[model samples]
Target chain A: MTEAVDDATLVQMFETMALVAATDDALRAAISAGSATLAYYSPRGQEAVAAGFAAALRPDDYLVTTYRGLHDQIAKGVPLRPLLAEMLGKAEGTGRGKGGPMHVSWPDVGLMLTTGVVGSGLPIAAGLAWAAARQGEGRVTVASFGDGATNIGAFHEAANLAAVWGLPVIFLCQNNGYGEHTAFADHLRVDHVAQRAAAYGMPGVTVDGNDPVAVHDAVSVAVARARAGEGPTLVEAVTYRLFGHVFGDRMTYVDPKELEAAWKREPVTRFRQTLVEWGLLSEADAAAIEERSATTAAATLAEVLELPEPGADEVLTDVVAPAGADATKRTARAATKVVVPDGSVEVSVRSAITLALDEALESDGRVVLLGEDISDSGVFGVTKGLAAKHGADRVRDTPISEQAIVGAAVGAALGGLRPVAEVMFMDFLGLCLDQLANHAAKLRYMSGGLTPVPMVLRTAVGGGLQVGAQHSQMLEAWLTHVPGLKVVVPSTPSDARGLMAACIADEDPCVFIEQVLLLSRKGVIDSTPIELGVADIKRPGADVTVVTYGRQVHQALAVADALTSKGVEVEVLDLRSLVPLDEAAVLESVGRTRRAVILHEAVVTGGFGAELAAGISEALFGRLVAPVLRVGALPAPLPYARGLERLALPGPERLLEALEWVMAYEG
Target chain B: MLLRLPKIGMEMTEAVLAGWLVDDGATVVKGQALYEMETDKVTNEIESPAAGRLRRIAQEGMTYQVGDPLAEIDED
Candidate 1:
C-alpha cells in the first residue's frame, strides 16, 4: 500500500503516460515502415515509470535509460517529432540516423545514453552522477532499468560503487511481471525486486507500478533524497508489460487470466479512476486528453514520413564528431615537411622537445600541458624548462589518476584548449583508454558531427633502455586501429619538434609518440617544416623499399647502408604518420623497387606491419617482384635479460634478414 | 661605444653572443634584450632591440651581451 498523490497532478501524470504509450505505438509502426525495417521495443505498460520520473526531474537533471526507453526519452524532454524521426531512421533523428532503436542519446536534453545492453546504462549513469557530485553541479542521475537488469554484473557493480561513493543517483526498476518470456517467480526468491537494494545499504521501496500516483510519489521521494546528497535509492514499481518484449514477441508465457487481470491494473486506467473519484476531471475531459494524444502522435508520424532519406554522402558523416567534408580535406592538406632553419643548430631529441613546447606555448595562448611531474622535471626533463619559462599557469601537475587526467584533458579540449597530455610511458596508455577511445575519439562522431574535440597526446615509447617489462612496451599498433585518431611517431629530433608543432596546429586529435632511445641521439636537421600524413624517404635506392618508423627507421637506414655495401640497392621510407597513412607514397616507392619490407617495434601478430603489407599487396599485386615482408618484435612479453631483449626487437640485423628474404623471394 | 651588463657582474671580461633576437639596425628601446648570450649554464638577453639606432659591435659566438661594449646606439 502507498500514500496517494494529489488528484490534479495524478490526472496530469496519467495523461502523460497515455500520450507516451500512444507515441511508442506510433513509433513502432513508423519504424517497421522505414527502409531499415527496424524493430522497436514499445514501453506500453511501463509508461508509469516515465511519467513518474519525468514529473519529478528538472530539465537540467540527466536521465540514462536502457533500450526500451522511448517513454523515458520522451519524459526527459525529447520531442515527439525527433523521437518519431529516430525510429524512422531519418537524418533529422536524435542521432542523425546513426544510432537506431538500441542507441538513443540526447545530451542536449539530458538523455545521456539509452543503450541496447540490458545493464550497461547503470554503470554509465553512476559515472555521470559521480561527476555531478564531485563538481557539486546540483545534478542527479536517474537510471531506469527493467527487472532483468537486476541479475546483471553491471547493475551490482554500479550500485555498489554508487553506494560506496554516496553518488546522487536513483536506480528505478520497472518490475513488469515477466522479463521477456520468464516470469518473476521463476527467476528470483524475493517477491519485490526493490528488496535487493537493502543488500547495498540503501533504502528500497516497492510501489503499485500500475498506479501513476503510486509511481510518482515513490519517484519524487527518491529524486528528492538524491538531490539532497543522501545518496542512491532504489524503487521497484510492480507492473505488467502489456506487449511482448519486442514488437514481434508472441508472449507465450503470459496466462490468459493473468493477462486480463493485469490489463485492469494498467497505470492509465488506475490513475484515471483515482482522478474521477477525486472529481479532478470529467469523463468528457478525460476523453479529450486521449483524443489530443492520438492527434499529436498522428502528427508526429506524418512529419517523420514526409522527411527525406539521408543522402549517399550522409553515410560517412556523423561517424565522427565535426562531421563534414572539411575533416577529410583538412586531413589531406597536412603534409609532413622537413624544416631546417639556417644556422639553427640541430639539438638532441629531449632538447628539441623542450624547445618545441617552449615555442608552442609562446606562440599559442590556448596551449596547456598536464601530467604527473610535468611541471617539475617532466619525468625525463623534456618539459623541464617549460615550468620555469611559462610559470605554473600553463604547466600543470596532476595526481596519478590517469582517468581523471585524460577525462579532464577531453573536457579542456572540448572547451577550446589545445591540451598536450603526457601519459609518462606508452605502456601506461592502457590505464586511460576509456577517455581516449570512448570520449575523445567517439564524442565528435556520436554527436552527429557537431562537436570537435582537438587534443594532442605526447607519450614516450620503445623498449631498448632496460626499463624492463612494465615500462618498455610499444603499443602504437593498438591505437592505430581506431578511426578518428591520427598517430605520429618521429625518428629524428627535428621530426619530434616539427611533428609536435604540426600536431598542435592540426584540427583533428593526434598521438605524438617519441621513442625513448632516440631522445639523446643527435642528427643534422634541415630547417624545413614538417606536416602530418606524409612519409619521408630517408634513403633513395631501387632494389627493395624498407618502410619503417620511430626507432626502427634508424635500423632500416642502417640495413639499407649495409645492403648497399653488399651490392644491393635498398630505399628507406620513414612513415612519420600512421593514420591517413602515406599509402600512395608507400605504393609508389614499393612499385619502383618491386619489393618491400615493413618494419616496426611492436609485436609481430596483428601489428601495423600487417596493415602495411596488405595495402602494398593490394595496390602493387602485379608490380611486385616479391610479396611484401614484415619484420617486427617477436610475439612475446619483453624479457628483462639484455640478450633476450635484443633478440626480441627488430634491429638492423633483423631488417637485413627480412630484406634479404624479400629480395630472394619471387612472387 | 655603449655597453650595459646583461645581468649582475662576473670576473669574465667578455661573453659569447649566441644570436640576436632582433636584426641589426632594428629599432631598439632602453631595457629591451635585443641579443641573446650564453653562459656556462644557460642563455641570457644581451641588451636592447631599442628605440634608438642599433649597431653590432659584437659578433655571434665571440662577443658578450654584458662585459664587452655590444654597440654604440645613436639616440634620435
Candidate 2:
C-alpha cells in the first residue's frame, strides 16, 4: 500500500469507500425489508478498489464495469440518490428504471456501460478508448471486470486489440476471489490474473485491493501510460467479496475460514484504522462519515421505493429515436426517394456492399468500419478495397472476438463515432449476443433517450452451398425480435446500396443481414436512393401476394414468372426492411391481391415469417379472401447434403406449391 | 464482320439492347464501346472486337439472343 498519498485525496477516498459500503448495507436492508426485490450484486469488500481506481481518473474518462458496479459508479461521481432510486425501480432513476441495477449507463459522468453478462465490459472499454483516440483526446477508459473475466474470449481480444491499436484504455480486473461463490483458484489456473497481461505485450500490475491508496497509486500509473498514448495497461486489484454474489445467494460453497479472515480485514473499517494511525483522519472524523453515509443510503432506498413506477406510455417512447420533430428530421436525413440506375448496371450483392460501405466511409468522418477479415476485403469480398480506400484507421480489422467486435462498436457509437461492426456470419452472433441484445438494443431506452446507439451490425444470413448446421442458419427472426433494433434485409443490389445508406444515416442500432446466395446474383442498381421501411414490388400482379425477403425474394419472383405462363398473376413483395416493417406496403399488396403467402429460408417454428403472417391475418381478418399462408423451412438444423439442404429451405418448388395452396383456399 | 454480344451468364439466352454508346458508321477502335446489353444476370458493355468503321445492324432497345449480331464493323 502507498503511504505517501496526500491527506485531502485520502479523505476523499475514505468518503467514497464509506458511501459505497453504506449503499451496500442499505440494499441488503431493502431486500430484507421487502422494499426492493431486484437481484443486487453487493460490492461490500470491493469498495476500496473503486475508491482507489477512480481517484486517478478525470470525469471525462470512460468506464465499463460489470453488474457489481455500484461502487464503481459511485466512485465515478454518479449521485447516490438517483442511483438508489434506480435500484428501487423509480422513474426518476438514472436509466429511468428501464435498466434496473444491472444495466446502468451514465454517460454524463463517463460511467458509460454496466452489464449483467460476465466478461463483456472489456471490449466495450476498448471501443471507448478507440473513440477517444480517434477524437485526439487523451481520455483513458477503465474496464473493470471479475478475475473470472480473464478466462473469457472478450478479455483476450480487448487486451490484444487495445494494445495493437494503441487505444488509451486501462483494463481493470477486480479480483474478488470468487465468480458467483466458486473460488478463483478453482476457476482460473493462473496464480494471478495480471500475469496473463504479459502475453498481450502490455504492462501488468497486481495491487492490494483492500488498501485504497495502493489501488489509486497502481491505477495512476496505468492512467498516465494511457494518456501518453502508450496504449493499454492491465491492472489486477486483488480483493475479496465479503457477501454473496447476489442478494439471496446462500454461499455454502465457500471456505468458512477464508471468509472469516476476509471479514476481519474488511476494507471500510480497516481503512479507517489506517487513517487514524497516520493522524490524517481522527477516529471521530471517520465515524461521522460512516454514520452519515448509512443514514442517507437507507433513507433514500426507502423513499425511492415509494416512488411511482414508470408509466405504461414510457414503453414505446425510446424503442427507436423519439417520435415527433426528431423523427421527421431523421426521416428527412435518412430517406432518399427510391431511384433506379439509368441503365442495367449489373452488380452482385458483395460488390454492392463494397460500394455502399465505401460511399458511407467517404461521406461521413464519424463512420468507421470494424470487424474481422474486413481489412482482408471481408471473407466474401464485401469489404474489398475499403481498408485501402478509407485508410487503416477507419476500416479497422479486429481480432476474432465477436464480443469485442460488437461490444466495442456500441461503446464507439456512444462515444460519438458511427461504427459499423460485422460478426462475419449470423451464427457467430451467439458468441456476442449479450452486447447486441442487452447493451445496444436497450441503451437508448435504458438511458431514456439520453444516448443514441447509432451503429450497424452487418452479418451474413441464410443457408446454401452445403455449409452445414452451425454455419448455415438464418437468424433474422432473433434480431427483428429485439424491439430497439432496426433489422434490414436487402434482396437486390439496388436495395442493398440504398437501404444500407439509410441504415447508416439512422439514429438507432440496426442489424443489416446480407445473403450468401445474393452475393453472386447480379442485378441492375439505380443511382436513386431508397428509404428504409419501404418495400419494393418485385413482380406486380393482381392474384396471390407472395411476401418474402433476402434470398427467398428471388424464388418468389421466379415462381411469379412461372405462374405468368399459366395466366395466374402473382405479386411478389420483397420486404427489404424488417423492423420498421413496411406494414403499409405488405397490406396494400395483399389487399389488392386478396391472397397472401409469407415465406423465408429460416425454420417455420420461430422464423420472422410467422410474425408477418400473424400481423397480416389480424389486419385483414374479415376482409381477406383466404388465411395467410406461410412457406418456410422445416423445423430442423440445416443439414449438409444438397438434397437435405434443398428440402430444409423454401425454394421455387416450395413456393409454387404454397402458392397453389393459398390460391385454392376458399376460406 | 459482325460485332455480336457475348454470353454473360448461363441462364441468359437473350437480352435487351439497352443503348448504343457509339454513332453508326463511326470509326471505332478495339475495346471501344459499341453498345450496352442488359441480361437477366448483369448489365455489360459490348465492346468492338476490331478497329473499323461501325455500321448498325440491329436497332437499339431490341431483344437479341447470343450470337445475334448487333453491328457490322468494316475494317478500313
Candidate 3:
C-alpha cells in the first residue's frame, strides 16, 4: 500500500470503483434488456480516476464533470437510488427527468454541474472556485473533462483565468487514449494534456490513471496546494476507454489488437489483483465487495425502474424563480432616483444606468460586475467609477475573452452570486452565446429548480449609429425567443433605471440591451422600479396603438406628437420587457384603437414586430380597421452609407407614414 | 484644407458632432483637439489636421457620414 493512502482509504477507493463498475454493468444490462432506454456513456475503464480524485476532495468541495460523468457522480457521493432513477427518467430523479443521463446536478453532495457541452465544466469550475475563494472556506473545485476538451477555446480561457486569479481549481483530464471515436494522437499535437498548463503558468502533472494510489497522491498534493491558495493545477490521467463512446456505437474505427490490449489492463481487475497481492484484501473479501456492489446496483435499478416518470406539469414548474425573490435578499440602500415635487428627476440614460448598478452593488453584497475595460469606467461611462467604489474584485476588468467573461459569470451565478456581465456590444454575443443560452438560460429548468442563475447579461446595441453592418444590431428578438431568459429594453432614462434594477434582482438570466443612441437622451426617473413583463403607456391616445420598444419608442412618440396637431391621437405602448410580454395591455390597446402598428429597429423580416403583429391580429381580430402594420428597418443589414442608412431604418417619417395609413384605412 | 470626418474605428462610418471645441474662424494649432464627435456611444475628440483658421461646416447635434467635411482649415 502507498504511504499516502491507508488500508481503509485504499479499500474505500476500491469500494467506490466497484460501485461505478457495477452501476455501469447494471445500466448496460438494463438497456440491452429493453428495460431502461438511455444514451449511456460507459465509464467502465476510467473508474479509478474519478474515485481517486473524489476521495481526495472534501464532501463540501465542488465537482464539475462532463456528459460521461457517471463514475464521477457516483464517487462524489450522489446516492445510487436517485442517480439510477435519474438515468431512468423518473420523477424523483435529480433533474426531474428534464436532464437525462447526459446532465445531472446534486448540489447537496457538491456535484454541482454535469455539462452536456464539451469543455464547458472548466470555466464553471473556475467560477465555483472564484466563489469559494471569496467565501474563505478553503474549499477547492475539481473539473473533469476528456483530453479532446483540452483543445476547445473554453479550456484555454478558463485555464488562463484560473491561473491569473490564483483560483483553487483542479483540472482533471482523463486522457483515455481516445476522444470519443478519434484517437488522442490524431487530435492533439502535444505529447500530454498536462503540457498545456505551462502556457497558463500552473503546475501540470501526468499520472497513471489505472493506479488509484497514483491518482490519489497527485490529487492530494493539488488539493493541499489549492487549499494554501497557491493556485490551480492540471492533472492528466492516462487511461483507456474499454467500451464505445455510446452504448450502441460500433467503434469500428478502433483496432481490435489495441482494444484487446486495453482490456487486459482494465482498472477494476488490475486494482483488485493489486489489493490481493498487498494482502490488504483477500480474494474472498474482494469478491464479497464486488458481489455487494453488484447486488446493490441491481436492487436500486429495479426500484428506480418502477418509479413514476415526471408529470407534464413539471415542464413549466422551474423555468423561473417566483417574483420578489430578489427582495428577500436585497438590503435597503440609498434611493437611486432623485425625486422632486414632480416625483421625478431628469437624468440621462447613462447616468440612470450607473445609478441602478451602484444601487444593486450597494444593496446586495453578492452583486458583482464583469466586462471588458469596465474597471476603468467602460467605453460608454455607464460603469464609470464603479471599480474604484466596489473594489477591483467585485468590479473586474477582464481580457478580451467574451466566452470566459460570460462563462465565468454564469458559474459565479451558479456559485451564488448575482453577476451583472457585459458583452460590450450586442454583436459580440455570438462569442458567448453557448454560455448564455445553453448554460445560463437552461440551468434552472435542467436542474428542475434546484439551482437558479440569478444573473444579467448587459450589452449595448447601436442601430442608429452608422457603425457599419457588424456593430449596429438590435437583436432583442433573439434574446426574447429563449424560454428561460428575461429580455428587457428601456426607452426612457426612468425605465432604464427601473428595468436595470429589476434585471439585477431577477432570479432568472436576463439580457438587458441598451440602445446606445439613447445613452445621452434625457428623461425623468424615480426610485419605483418597473415590474418585468409590464408595459408602460408612454403616450395614451385613441386613434391607433403603436406597440414598440427601445429606440423605436421615441419615433413612435414623435409621430404621435405630429399627428396630435393634425387632430389624430395615437396611443403608444412601450413594452419594457418582451419574454413575458404584456399581452393584456396589448390586447386592450389594440381593441380600443381598432388598429395597431409595431415599430422596432431590427430588420422587418423575422423581427420581434412580426410576433407582436401576429398576436394582435389573432387576439383583436375582426375588431380592427386594417391589417396590423410593422414598421422596422428594411430587409437588409444596416448600411454604412448615410443616405442608405436613413432609408433602411424605420425613421420618424416612417412612423408618420404608418400612422397616416392606419388613420386613412377603411374596411 | 478640408477637415473631413476621420473614421474613428474600423466599423465607424458616421459620427454625431457633439460640439466644436474651437469656434468658427478660430486659429487652431496642428495636433490640437478641435471637435468632439460621438461614435458608438463614445465621445472622441477630433484633432485639427493643420495649424489654420477653422471654418465650421457641420452644425452641432447633426450626424455626418465619414469623409464628409466637418470644417475647412484655411492654412495660415
Candidate 4:
C-alpha cells in the first residue's frame, strides 16, 4: 500500500490541498465583497479528500461531481478563472454566464459534469467508463456524491449496472458528517455508507478522509483495479463540513460541540503538520505555498470581475441541436437503407413499430434498446422478437428502476450509442421525469452545445385500456412544453414507422409517444421516410378545419365521413411533430376553411389543442367564419369505470357533436 | 354442433349479445362474421365456426355468460 504513496505523490497532494484551501478563501472573500452573490457551498474542511483523489486520477480519466464540488473541479485541472467567472455571471465563464458555480463543467479537461441534483451523476459515470471499455482505452471514471445521495435510486441503479456490465468506474461517497442540515447518523440506516456496496457485488472501503496520504493510497488502489478491468469499487471518505449547507444558512441546526471537534481536525492544518513532522518541508515553505495559491486566486478573481455580461442575442442560441444537422443526419440515414417489411401491403400500428425497431437495429450498430420487459418481448409487444434477432447485448432488460433506465440512456447516448429506452406506460413517466426534464432536455443547451443527446424515450399512452389512473393518461403536453425536446406522436401506422425513423436519426433527444388504441388499426407504409414536423392533410375539404393528432386524427377523419352527406365539408389536419409544429399548414387550412376546431385526448385546460387554438386566433384574426372550438377530455382524472372512461375520452360521437356546434354558429 | 361464446379478457365472465349479422336458419360460410359481442370496455365481432345453417339460440341485447351456447350451425 505504501508503494502507491511515495514522497513525490504526498507532495502533490499537499499542493492540491493548499490550492483548494486558497480557492475557498477567494470564493468566500468575493462573496463577502458583493462581487459574487450565488449561494456557495464551501468544502473548506474536506479539501484533503479531493486533493488525495485528484492525485490518484490520470490525466485522461473522467470525473463527475456535485454542486459542492469546487475543490474537486480545481483539482481535476479546470482553470479557476473560468470557474470563478461562471460564478460571477460573466461572458468568459465556463458556460458563458449560463451555468453559474453550481453547474460548472469543463469536459475538455475530463471534468465532465457537476450536476445540481444529488446522486444523478452515478449513471453518467458508468456510461463514461463503459464507453472507454468499449474503445479498449484503459481509462477509469470516478463519480462523487454526497452521503444523502447514497439513499437515492440513481446511486443503487448505477452501482448495479456498473457491476453487472463490469464497467471501469469508482463510486466515491463524500460523507461530510452532514447532508444539508441532517447528520449522517440520523439520515442513514447503515453504520457506514460503504457497506451498501456489497449488495451490488463490489468491494467497499471506509477511509479517514482528513488524512491526505491515506485517502490517496485508497483511491490509487481503486483506480488501478478499475483500469485492470476488474470493475467498480465504492469508496466512502468520512469528513466534516465547516460551513453550513449554503453560504447564508445559519448554524442553529448543528451542535456546537460537534462543530468544534471537527474544526480541530481541519484537513489543511492536519496535513501541513504531517508534512512538517516528516521533515519533507519546513514551516516557512508551507506558508510560502499557501501564499502562492492565494495570490493566484486573487489575480484570477480580479480578471473574472472585469468580464462582460451576455447580450440579448444569447436568448435562443443553444436551446436545440444546431441547424444543418438534419441534412447530414438525413444523408447518413440514406446509407442505412432500413428496409420496411412488405412495403406493398398494409399492417397495424403495432406491427409498424416492430418493423421500425427492426429496421433501426439492422441499419445502425450504434442503436440499442433497454426497458423493464423488452428483452421478454415487452408488455406492449413492440419489441417482440427483437432480442432474438439483435441479441441480448443490444436489446437488454432492466430492473424496474425508471430513473436508472432513463439516466443510463442519457449517459449512453453521450457515450456514443443511440438508445431507444421504453418506460412501458406514460403514467410511469412520473418516476423518471427528472432524468428527462433536467438532464436529457437541458444537457445540450447547458453544456453550451458541446453535448447533444440523440436518444429516444418510447412510451405507450391512452385512456381506453381501463388500466385505471396509474396506467392510462395522455401526458404528451408535458414533454412538448420542454424547449430542447422533440415530441413525436404518430397518428397512423405509416407515420409510426416513418416518423420513428426520422426521430431516431435526428441528433436531438426526442419523446416518442405511442397511442395504444391506434396500435391495432391497420395503415399503409413504405421504406420512403416521412419528413418530421410536416403536418399531413389526412382528409381535405372546405367548410371547417379540424386540427388534431395521434388517436384524435382518426376521430377527425370519421367526423369528415359522417358530415359529408349533411351538406358540411370538413378538413382534417394531423400535426405529427408537436415541438417543431407546422404553423403554416395550420394557418393555410384555417384560411381556406374559415372555421377551426381543435381536438386532443389530454384535458382541455392546458392541452396542446389550446396552444393551437390560441395561435390560430392570433394568426387568422377577422378571417374566421366562426369562433374556434376545442373538444378535449374532461378536467377530472380518467376513472376505471367503462362508462366514465368513454365519457372522459372525446371520440367520434363527441367529434360529431362538436361539428354540429361549429356548423350552427355565428361569427 | 353448438357455438359457445369465447372469453376475450382476463376478468371477463360474460358478454352482451350486441347484435347479429345473420338470421335463424341462414346458411353461412366458415369463419364468417356472425354477430357482435360487447365486453365492458370494447365491442368485438364474433365469427362463425362452420359453413352450414345458422340457428339463432340467443336474442340481441341479451347477456350471455362464458361456455353458454349462442347458436348451432348444422353441417351440410
- Which tens-of-lDDT digit does each residue in A13-108 have in candidate 2? 999999999888777644432235566788989999999999888899998888899999999998877787777678888878777788787888
Better of 1 and 3 by TM-score: 3
Error of 2 at A570 (Å): 1.3
How displaced is residue A266 in candidate 3, in Å?
0.8
Q: What TM-score does each of the candidates earn?
A: 0.66, 0.85, 0.87, 0.86
Q: What is the CA-based DockQ of model 4?
A: 0.00
**Candidate 4 residue runs with Cα over 4 Å from true position:** A1-3, A334-338, B1-76
Model 3: residue A516 alpha-carbon error in angstroms: 0.8
Summed over model 4, clashes come to: 0
What TM-score, to 2 decimals, does candidate 3 have?
0.87
Model 4 C-alpha lDDT per residue in residues A259-315, reported as the tens digit of each score: 899999999989988999998789998899899998898788878878898776766
Candidate 2: tens digits of C-alpha lDDT, residues B6-70: 55423556779899899988998865767877876557665565578989887888998766767
Q: Between which residue pairs do clashes occur in model 3?
A: none
Candidate 3 docks with a DockQ of 0.00
lDDT of each: 0.74, 0.83, 0.86, 0.83
Query: What TM-score is obtained by chain A of candidate 1?
Result: 0.72
Q: lDDT per residue, candidate 1, B28-65, as tens digits?
A: 77546576666664455544422487776767777543
- Could you give the DockQ of candidate 2? 0.00
